[model samples]
Target: TDIPHFSTTDWTWAKGALQTVDRPYGPLLNLLHHGIGSTHVCHHINPRIPHYNAWYASALLKNNFPDLVRYDSTPIHKALWRIATRCTVVSQRGGIDGYFYQPKPSI
Candidate 1:
């Protein structure tokens, strides 16, 4: 299934949402910022938080750490295209644990 991309800055929410709602042929990816996707921010902060209560937990975090928590409103299809075209290389930086995508330099 094709997944929606939110932003180039951070794709944690998008990835998690895709994993959670992904289905055969096509996914129900339109349910953005809801269900597992909405609670993704909270999940990263506290893995122990259950999915049922993630939305509430996320709201709290959003109020406290506005800078740290990012919610990209970009449509998934656009973000996916941007990522696919720009994020061409996957390599580690600083150390093995620090992996990232690097765009190909313009000719």
Candidate 2:
């Protein structure tokens, strides 16, 4: 199922929601902040949180948004976990300034 996949827009939405004031799933966000790393790392250790909002969106589609206790069991979540696990290699020497993206040069 090519469920539209996730895009940059989806990432924006997740970022916005993560910074919201509600703080319903605060711990999850914290875990993502502390446990997860860059997109490349997440792509291997676990791309779940990266695509976390997608599952949220999915639940909303099924009218089970509020019922979604967590996303740890979802495929997207597992994929993200795997990505994160593999991305973090201490032996790998590289810059952490922006592993997943680069900021545009200032004008």
Best by TM-score: 1
lDDT of 2 by residue, 11-64 (tens): 454443332111123456546654232222222322455454444444453364
lDDT of 1 by residue, 36-104 (tens): 554555666667887667767878877986755656554556666877888776665553333456777
TM-score of each: 0.53, 0.17
What C-alpha lDDT, on a 0 to 100 scale, does residue 41 get in candidate 1? Answer: 59
Top-lDDT candidate index: 1
Model 1 residue 47 lDDT score: 72
TM for candidate 2 is 0.17
- Cα RMSD, each candidate: 9.1, 14.7
Stretches of candidate 1 above 4 Å error?
A: 1-34, 90-100
